[model samples]
Target chain A: MKLEFSGGVLTAFIDGEIDHHTAPSIRETIDKTILQDKPDVLRLDYSGVTFMDSSGIGLIMGRYKLISSCSGKIEVINIPRNMAKVVKLSGIERLGRITIKED
Target chain B: MKAINTMKLEIESRSVNESFARVAVASFISQLDPTIEELGDIRTAVSEAVTNSIVHGYKEGKGKIYITVSIFENAKVTIKIRDKGCGIENIEEAMQPLFTTMGGERSGLGFAVMESFMDKVKVNSVVGKGTSVTLEKKINGRFVTKW
Candidate 1:
């Protein structure tokens, strides 16, 4: 995962697969960035993500809580077509809008 | 369904091995010529069950995860994943969505996702023994030739 913060927006470019084993590190990195940078918007970019399970959902939900706790909103963007079903199934829209970046 | 082809995999319960286990099983079943949707669903389901073994089951310890992938005729498949870790005391509560034993780190959606993607998901466990998750999927995909 890669992190970039500009204009108070912290965007994480998630790559590869996300599962229970890999989610913690991604979560930790994002959380640490959120605290240190205190970005106004947390944007989780999934353009490079090839696969995900429910563990991905957990990562998003956890970040939602963390960001919202500190008054920051989260936006999940650029989801691959294949991974969109699981994302929708997780009901993450409550956290915010989920936009799929078109190729 | 009668299993015409079968393969067994045993891997150490390490976080790093999670992707290996799922991809291995997915590759094993790919001979059935599953559609992309079918393949993706299987990969996601396999990842969940194996991760459950590593996380909630083993819980920060080392163990072994046993996986059995069986390919039946007519593009149907079944995967059985087992682990000798601490078992769940309550299967019902555990299956509920967003009910994580690990709190915020986990989404508590493993079983639920398996149930969604697969045709059938059966979970059996003994408190002190281990847990076995069996996921079944019938591929209604395009025509295929079996190798």
Candidate 2:
């Protein structure tokens, strides 16, 4: 996971399969960045992610809570079709808008 | 109803093995020439089941998770994930969407995902005994003759 921050916006570039084994670390990193950077917007880039399950949903929900508490916004970009289904099924759009980049 | 092919695997109830289990199942079922969407659904469903065993059943403790997959002649696949760890007290409640006992760390969508992805999902559990989740899906007509 790589994070870039600029102009009150933090973009997280996450790669690999986001599952139970990796979600904790990802959550920790995002939380730490949100705390230190205090970015007004959190953009999650999921183009490189090969797989994801409910654990990924939890990660996003947890981050939404943290970012929303600070009155910040969250956006998910470049979600693959398969993952977008999971995200939509989990009703994550209620928390933030998910943008799918054309491949 | 005899299965045309069957495979069974037993692995430690560890988080790291979740991906391995899913990928293994997907590879095995690739013989049926499932579409990309169907394969993804099966992998996602298997991932949820194995994750439930590791997180809820084993609670990060040591245990064994058994995954049994069988492909029928009709192109229907059945996957059973069993764990000899702490089982749920109420199977009905556990199957509910967003009902997690792990506080906020979990999304409580394991069973929900399985139900959505698979045609049928059956959860059988006895507290202090163990839990087994059975998921079944029928692959639509998309057989790859190359295999």
Candidate 3:
């Protein structure tokens, strides 16, 4: 339901659904982690993630901005097919910054 | 008469984060061992529901939104997203695909997408009170419940 961070890599093992109703928690968790751990890299594992919309794009973009500002890299792995469709449609892949991998 | 297995959250409308919420909930339900296609369906349904709330439910401005996700032991998960904002005047018209009231930019496919992906979809709305959407789906097979 929230963020579970560990290792040198801070992973947000997000639970429940991610939407306008649930994104702020993720944003806050990521922001807080960035400030605290200052991890060199951030990984958003979408393997467990279920749904996403255009608003989800903004969430990833915001994190990209946050991590980039801190001189850190952001990678997205284990994305599902349906969710991937939306992400690709957003042209985020064109940015070539979000690293998507299968689970 | 069974206790609802649900997780609830209240979120702000200003910050962009609904996608994260949708994905998170989908990930949780996927643990029930849904097939690849079933997983996709769940994800799409969640996305459509969340998008509707963000784009239509809270269109006026920033406000509080409620999202609840429930996974039954039978591999049927229900997601209820609610918002207290200007409600739709006609549910039937709004449910129509490509019937977006927001100019033509709105795909008007929110409910359609949800129906296409989920087993059951229900919307309850009032002209001014608010709107509540409930989406339900049953995974292909059964699984031993693990907590």
- Which of the numbered candidates is closest to the native, going by highest DockQ? 2
What does candidate 1's lDDT look like per residue over B1-147, in tens digits?
Answer: 578999999999998888998889889987877889988999999999999998888996999999999988777789999999999999999999778878886878888889989999999999989999999998776565553
Q: If the candidates were sorted by their DockQ against the true structure, best first, what order would they fall in?
A: 2, 1, 3
Interface RMSD of 2: 0.7
Model 2 lDDT per residue over A39-82, tens place = 99999999989999988889888898899999999998898877
Residue-by-residue lDDT tens digits, candidate 2, B1-147: 999889999999888999999999999998888889999999999999999998889989999999999988678889999999899998988899999998777898988899998999988998899999999998874753332
Q: Score the docking of each candidate (DockQ).
A: 0.84, 0.86, 0.12
Query: Which TM-score value belongs to model 3?
Result: 0.57
B63-129, model 3: which lDDT tens digit per residue? 7778888877666788888888787889999988646676423345567667767889999998778
Model 2 ranges off by over 4 Å = B144-147
Clashes of each: 0, 0, 18
Highest TM-score: which candidate? Answer: 2
Q: What is the lDDT of residue B57 in candidate 1?
A: 87
Instruction: Note the residue pairs that clash in candidate 1.
Output: none
Instruction: Say which candidate scores most in lDDT.
Output: 2
Ten-residue stretch with the least lDDT total in model 1 chain A: A94-103
